[model samples]
Target: MEVTPLINYINRIVTLTPEEEIILSEYVVYRQYLKDQYILQQGDVCKHANFIVKGCAKTFHADNNGQEHIIMFSVEDWWASDMGSFITQTPADYNVQCIENTELIQFNHETIEELYAKIPKLERCFRQITERALVSSLKRIVRNFSKTAKERYIIFKENYPEIEQRIPQYMLASYLGISKEFLSKIKSQLAKETKS
Candidate 1:
């Protein structure tokens, strides 16, 4: 698969000279996964930082009751990984699963380290990306604690318009920390309001 999307994302943060781009490209590996496939399972070390080139995936963890809670969804041009595990080289508490047949460009830890050594600007690029992701996660946590289910649902739809259509209603409910029935009611209310 062409790595234009990944390269484009990098260029947005820091300009990459042709030689630098070539060096970065040397470390990228392309992979395809079928829908429902587990890219990173709970207890397994997350070996790569995956960028979705096509399709969607989710990061989630199951509770002792075997109930799963979604942490986030990643669509085309977005990333999905257990960052803690990827960085620490330890087992992950969450799972990253493909929601559709997905194509990804992945960079393994060793390759990333090599890129950092060979192209230091690339290190800054990734650092910025990770920092942004961390901030987004913190904001979501705060919103989940403070926002009502309806409000959270609306915000989720607004933030993930592309993802909203591709995932199942129950999965969306899980992401919003609400029940499927409640989500259905929320949608009905929104539909009526839209019609009036």
Candidate 2:
């Protein structure tokens, strides 16, 4: 399997020599899922931290009424996991599903621990990844509380223009915590503004 994305992502956080990359390869597993296939499900333990190689996935939770509330989206070169579940070896509160045919490289808890032991520098790299994920989560929570729906939609579009092209409008609406009709209106207004 192609590993350029994973290599480049790691290189961004920490330098990796050829030997170090070989060590990392030992712990990484590749998987492919079709669109709509689940990488994880609510109440199931999340065993791996998944790095997207070629597609997209979303993390979401279903309420008691069975309505899904999207938590986040991960596209190519991004990572996603219920880190709490992966680290604690407990059931996940959220589900991660492929939004398109996807290729991913994943490292399970045991493999990660082994990697850390074998490659001390990896611990620092992984820590940075965790920290960034936490900061992004906090930012999203703050934005949800403070921003208007239209403002949030605008931010989403700016951050994930390619994602908007790939995902269904209804899914995008769910991610933005708005109804499909409202998202439609917002898109129409933005389109008109751009045309003028």
Best by TM-score: 1
Model 2 C-alpha lDDT per residue in residues 1-196, reported as the tens digit of each score: 6677898899998999999888888789999999999999999999899999999999999999999899889999888788889989999999999999999999988778788998899899989988999999899999999999989999998988888888888888999999999999998999999999
Candidate 2, backbone clash total: 0
Model 2: per-residue Cα lDDT at residue 55: 91
Query: How accurate locally is residue 35 in candidate 2, as Cα lDDT from 0 to 100?
Result: 96
Q: Write the per-residue lDDT of candidate 1 for residues 120-176, one digit (tens) a residue.
A: 998888899999999999999999899999999999888778788899999999999
Q: What would you estimate as the lDDT of candidate 2?
A: 0.91
lDDT (Cα atoms) of all candidates against the true structure: 0.92, 0.91
Clash pairs, model 1 backbone: none
Candidate 1 local accuracy as lDDT? 0.92
Lowest summed lDDT window (length 10), candidate 1: 107-116
Query: Which whole-number lDDT from 0 to 100 does residue 15 have in model 2?
Result: 96
Colliding residue pairs in candidate 2: none
